[model samples]
Target: MTNVLLDAHLNAKLADFAGSSLDGSPLLVVVTKSHRRPGDTCCVEADISAFASTLYTIVTGQSPYHDLSDYKIDERFVHGSFPQTDSLGPLGKLISRCWRDEYPDSKSVCKEIQGMC
Candidate 1:
C-alpha cells in the first residue's frame, strides 16, 4: 500500500491505502482521500485518478475540484488531485467541484435532481 500525505486541520496522520473500494462501500469512498498514507511509497492517486474523480461526483452528486471559480462537473473527467481515488485534499470540496461542473447553473441542478427523483 502507498502512503500519501494528507493535510489535516491539526496534523496529518498515517493510514492504510486502498483502491476502488468505493464500488463496494460508500462510506469508504467518501473518506478515501482523507485516509493517511501508512508508509511513504504507494500512491493510489495516480492509479485511480480518472475513475475516482468521476465516481466521487456521481456517487455524491457534488463537485470534484477544490477551487471551481470557472469549473464544471462531468462524470467523464474530473482530473486533478483528490482525496479518494486521488490525493487532493478534502473529499467534500472535490465532490462539490464535480457537482458544480455537472450542474453549471441552477437549471442544471434542478434537472439533475429531477433525473435522480
Candidate 2:
C-alpha cells in the first residue's frame, strides 16, 4: 500500500518547486484525472470568480485553464491561446476569458458566465 503521508509530501514538494500556488502565474491542474461525477455539470452562474471557478470545477474538475504541465499533462494555457474542448460546450466562451484576459478578474469572469447562463 502507498503511504498517504509520503504521497502528500511528494506532491507538496512538487507543487512548491512548480509554482502551482504562485500568483500572476498560470493556474495549475493539480488533479491528474477528472474528478467530476458522471453526468456532473456546472450550471451555477454568479458574479463571483470563486463561484465561477466552482462551476468550472463541477464540469471539468479543474480550475479554469489549468496548467497541469508539471504532471506531464498539457492544458495549453499560453497567453492569448485557447484550445477547443467539447466538454465545455456552451461554457467555452466564458472560460475563454481566462486565456484571453477577457475579464479584469475572476469576478468579472463569473459575471460573464452568469450572463451567458
Candidate 3:
C-alpha cells in the first residue's frame, strides 16, 4: 500500500512537471489574475482559484480554457472571462465564486464543499 501511494505521488509529480496527465491529456495549471501580474505575492485567493479550477477539470475532464493558447487564456483570465459553468450545477457555482474572488479564504471554500457533501 505504501508503494502504491508512493507510485501515485511520483506519477502525479512527473505529470505536473511534464505538463500532461499520465493518460497524455494536457495538464492545466490554474493561474489566477493576481498570479499573472508582475511582483504579486501568492495569496489564499490563488489557492482557492487553483482548487476550484482543478475540481472543474476533474469534473469536466478538461481545463476551463482548454481550447485556447496559454497567452489567450491568460488574457481572458485577466479580463475576468471564465468558462461557463451552468451545466456543472452546484459545483459550477462554487467554481465561479472562487474565480471571482468572492470567498475570504481557502477554508471557507472547504467548508462550503463539506456542507455540500
Candidate 4:
C-alpha cells in the first residue's frame, strides 16, 4: 500500500518484537558479512535502521524493507533512507543514534540500553 501504511505496520511489528523480554540472553548479537557493525557504515541511518530492521524481522517474520521492491534494496540501504518502524518504542530513539553514528561502538549501545532498562 502506501509508505505510511507500511511504516505503521513495521512499527507495530517492531513493538511486538522489541517490547518483550528475551527468553535467556538479554542482548541479541547480529553478524553481517561485512566485518563492521551495520551502523559502522558511512551512512549512519543505514546502520541504525539495519539494527532496527533486524529486530523487526525477529518479531514479525518479515523484512523491514519488504515494501521497497522497485528500487534496489541495497541502494536504499547505502543511502540510509529506509523507513523506520516504531516497534522499539523509546528504544528505537536510542538505537537511532547508532544509525546516526552518535555512539562510538556497540559497547556504548549496550551501556545505554542497560541504563534505559
lDDT of model 1 at residue 43? 33
lDDT of 4 at 52: 55
Please name the candidate that would achieve the greatest TM-score relative to the true structure.
3
Lowest summed lDDT across 10 adjacent residues in model 2 is found at 35-44
Cα lDDT for residue 86, model 4? 59
lDDT of 2: 0.40
Superposed by TM-score, candidate 2 places the C-alpha of residue 9 at a distance from the truth, in angstroms, of 33
Ranking by lDDT: 3, 4, 2, 1
lDDT of 4: 0.49
Q: Assess the local accuracy of residue 76 in candidate 1 as a C-alpha lDDT between 0 and 100.
A: 19
- TM per candidate comes to 0.21, 0.36, 0.67, 0.46
RMSD of each: 16.7, 12.3, 9.1, 11.0
Model 4: CA > 4 A from native: 1-50, 59-61
Residue ranges of candidate 2 with Cα displaced over 4 Å? 1-57, 61-75, 79-81
Each prediction's Cα lDDT score?
A: 0.38, 0.40, 0.65, 0.49
Off by over 4 Å in 3: 1-41
* Model number with the top lDDT: 3
Q: Per-residue alpha-carbon lDDT of model 1 for 1-117, expressed as tens digits?
A: 123334657444545544335343422332323222112212333233333344455455553444443223222134433434334344534444443344344454345445554
Sorted by TM-score (best first), the order is 3, 4, 2, 1
- Candidate 3: tens digits of C-alpha lDDT, residues 11-30: 42212333224554533653
Work out candidate 1's RMSD over C-alphas: 16.7
- Alpha-carbon deviation at 41 in model 3, angstroms: 5.8
